[model samples]
Target chain A: MRFRFTGIFDLFNQKNEYYLINKKLDTIIQINESMYKVLSNAKQGTELNCNEINLNTMNILIYNRVLEAIN
Target chain B: MKRDLNKPIVIHWCMNNCNKQGQIPKGVIEGKIRQAEPIKIRFINPRSQEDWRIIESFANESSDIKEIQVEYDFLEYDIKHCIDIDIEKKLIYLVAFSGTSYLDHDARNRLCNMIKKQDNFKIIVYISHKNIAESVCFIQSVYNEVKQGEFIIKPEKNIKNELTDISVLHEAISQIAELYKLFPDIKLSVYDEEKIVRDIIRLPYYMYGNMYITGDGNISMYSFMPAYNYGLSDPQVTLEEAWRKLYHEHATCDLEKILEYPRYWFKYFNRKEIK
Candidate 1:
């Protein structure tokens, strides 16, 4: 279904690699360009269709608890 | 000409290998210099071995420099020699990191005794990312030591990275804000709305009547960002000439336009709820 990015995370690009830094957990996880684009465009509390992103990658992100489903 | 003591004079201590060293022109100190008002000088938290050696050497070169007060960093190096000489003078102990945790109870007691003896002294704790409860307890331990002195908690700046997360920065601001509630008397360097707006029209606080003396003896009107270079301090330039150049050049730039950038604007402006 639809999903949104977490508010506790900060997105940044360093050395051509994109990282999501979770301030609450003090953790950083690197993601690919496609994931970066999707996350960057997804506003907090807004829903994004699963078809908008690669289903396999989206599954991995949700599994890792980086992205949460809104509906 | 005698300088007025009432006016504020801010001095920035720089080491020889400072990043701005290359920017200073050579042989700028050959001319006669003007004398300014006599102000008390203090050195704060000099860390590097090279910096310490240069400071020691600089002090030895001039007896006047040796008399200047200092706030020694207990975490960096042994300040026994500095304490021995300036025992009677105003001393400051800057505790950063988990510096207090490293000291044994007896040593901590001795340190407090030394601080209590000084007529004018301060214990400034630089807040860091360490556990807040542990940090507060460390401060309280030293608090029990001194009878009368200023205890300040300052938020440390994140100077390394140009881009800092807004959330992280706000968290730091909130933490330091809470300290004011605990110790109402503590002073902070952050600007209020009045100060920020005042600076927007005029020069920022750091630029006002300030002089930076680098380790190589070069002088600049502004410490980190000098609009105009005043050359070396050895040959000596008049404080009037330096101020004139700094004020004149700084006035020409549109600070408002400069402040419009997200990073600069964010520093002075805070969002408040409309309700």
Candidate 2:
């Protein structure tokens, strides 16, 4: 596998769900790297070491991508 | 007659103790050489372990096991330089207990050195030992995580329960796959239930993700973050209890198809940059 230095999911779709989104809607999503540059380096309710995805978006992540996947 | 010359050779670094107890299940060693057409297996067992001797005694010459060698802790040596790494068919399966896979500064350094010397070879290393992930890592309770259908962790202990959970998880992963398919890095590990005693007297405790998911029925998904030099939290996955049911009275796959559900994008910060 290629070494992903800064991106976790890199905006990719997974075959499985990380967890359920409808139920997991409350959870936060994490982003860093160029993707973070786009996301502004944030994950959920709080401003993590990175940034917060203060707003919702359209996407999918199996496991780590669970909540991030849901639109 | 011993082995198809066509197959490349794969070595099993049994070390004396580990391989001594285990023998290559006959047909596998032979048929795999033919069908998989990869390589013949070279069994390396330490001559000292009498327990392993008993297992090897069971094998006959017809088994087609190549040469048997003694002595070599895989961890200590730079295997790549010695082995014919050029042989694309070569695969190494290492099985040693705390003696080899232990997490110490010295041992870790040795292992890192060996791995660093590694080239294009497909190396598979197995840490043979008791399940100590519970004590060594931080395990936390995670509520119903159905999104990624399957959680990643080193599978250890409580098999009877893990199997049941896995079957369900598999189905969920399948569903998720249908929606958004494709992921790299898939791993599967098998354990020996050969010595485990099953009780027919009474049914073991089993629950479907309930508040009290009987101890026997849960699997810990340990998160090993590459970014973090240390380990990440390992969360428990007890399906029913963790997840609240999504009661969407109606279905909408057609809508999902039209929308072409977007993939989740997770950005990562350089480990050094993150404070």
Candidate 3:
């Protein structure tokens, strides 16, 4: 299934690490380079495999509605 | 000594409404932003084709800017301008205007058409209470017709009085919260529950990191704070230094009052009257 970021999210790079802030969810998540790449790819319309990302991370993200599944 | 004080995260560029020609040159604006390198750039009431083009250029450019927003105040001349060019950055558009005593069908239609042409344009319809009394029917017509925007019903005089009286401010907040419950889309100017929480976490208070700069080079950290009085008058002080100083001074914030006052109306207010 394809997934996209839901609502408005601000991505900022600080001290060589990336963080994603979602104002609607009142969330600020520190993302590793790999997770950042996955999000960047998804942003560019790349199909993401569910198994490619950690199950816990995916579950948390989906639970927060940060990443919504799209057909 | 806060880390973010090293530089302002956002800088607002406000154009001269009376004489659009009185604006700082585009090259100078570009130079300042490049030097300051704020995370976001906001253009407030950019009227002419030249203004739109500058906005379009900034929107299209690949830079450190995470957001580009426009707060457009409609005058007779503004309805003719539209954002037709392609933009890479997502823009948050807040539109507020005072209405005449009568319904302006032509202006309303023009506004609707302009809104139709863009994506991700969230408008905040802030009508002055006096105008509301005169043009309630006009406002209602636009409200029913324009389904894409957010609405805020506030009084003009309350801009100062509400801030000084905390109880009245609380009542206003309750009223706005009740309004939100009735209509989920309508929100208090700066009181989005999630946004408030997010702001607290990210900064000392909501809008703490944001600063405004006028065409003539005056700067202010808060909307209510007069740019002329609290501006970057001292050439020795850099943008970052001035911001840090202001941050230290206003630590005990007027959070509720700040939320009540709309930032766009900062320009419209007479300097002598605000206090």
Candidate 4:
């Protein structure tokens, strides 16, 4: 339903440039050059799955733990 | 589809005044069939004490759920009912640290440190503060730093009395301590009343989490938090994708990394890292 592009914007650890394509809504929000790097560098790729902790924590789980690396 | 074009089966953490959140909080039952049918209702935040009761009354109002879930994470008041696990999607809506208090950064650091200790977990964290990690990520990806505060949360109505006493704080800290005891293998550290962060030390690697609680009611870390994490939807709630989504973006998202873009973390926060 939603599509996005992610990659490093620079070598130093500043700026971001990611493009989000919401196909369902026909909208593309280009992230700032600084932020794109922060999100992408946050973690590496993996598979996402659902396990039950409570009742409300089940919607979208990514398969990667890469969200951590980012500050 | 599931409903009219104008309506989607939205899972809302309805607050007391559209900011407090939650209307009910039982495992599952029955309740009023309104715009969102077959959807569970839980009280998230409240303008007054009465707001929570109204939501609790509806917890069993719906006969659809088998159990109720509640989480009071905020320091001020029981913020609201947390998100239930959406099993099919492998996603979870997590409670976020959103206020502009010093506690905001503290909670974020705690969450980041706590969750990162594990190898497998997922959380679609809800954000309350702009400087908080999740909100920061969302802002960097979608909005300008100047506009990040747009989504900041406040008491829908200024009623005050949201702060907690030391006794209540003790109860919360102990509950988490017990949770750590239950899940021995999961990553966590028990808090010692006398020891502060700098004075803290780890258990011997060999003796780490080797103990367990017997059938008796003996309180033990070995039998607590890890099990708590294991039993709760926590195992299923934390998403591997959610973590990677941020990391992958961070890897190549820097302006310099992406087409020679230039940006700084401090530039956005506009605060020096008091070294």
**How high a TM-score does candidate 3 get?**
0.59
For candidate 2, write residues B67-139 as lDDT tens digits.
Answer: 2222234454444443444431233334232212445566445444443343311122221123333212211
Predictions in order: chain A TM-score: 0.67, 0.19, 0.76, 0.28
Q: Which segments of model 1 are wrong by more than 4 Å?
A: A1-71, B1-8, B15-34, B45-69, B83-87, B90-107, B128-137, B144-148, B158-207, B216-229, B233-240, B251-258, B261-275
Show how many residue pairs clash in every candidate, following the order shown. 1, 35, 0, 136
- The residue-by-residue lDDT of candidate 4 on B12-66, one tens digit each, is 2323323223223222111222322412222333345554454454453544322
Q: Write model 3 residue lDDT over A1-71, tens digit each, in one string.
A: 77887645656664455556554322345567777777777666677778779887787678666688997
| Ten contiguous residues minimizing lDDT sum, candidate 1 chain A | A21-30
Candidate 2 or 3, higher TM-score? 3
The prediction achieving the highest lDDT against the true structure is 3
lDDT of 1 by residue, B157-269 (tens): 32232213467556655655665566665432332222233343442212233455554544443332323445445345665565556555662353444355444433223
Q: Which candidate number maximizes TM-score?
A: 3
Q: Second chain of candidate 1: TM-score? A: 0.56
Between candidates 1 and 2, name the one with more favorable DockQ.
Answer: 2
Model 2 chain B lowest lDDT segment of ten: B223-232
Q: Give a tens-digit lDDT track for model 3, residues B1-275.
A: 12233456667777554554554555555555656767667788776677787877777777777778787776435533466435523676666554453326776676676556655544443434334333344444554566555443434432443322456545545544554464456323433332243335434212355666776666665443455434344444467766666566652243333444544233234354443
| Candidate 2 local lDDT, residue B238 | 17
Clashing pairs in 1: B33-B236
Q: Which lDDT values do the candidates have, in the order given?
A: 0.46, 0.25, 0.56, 0.26
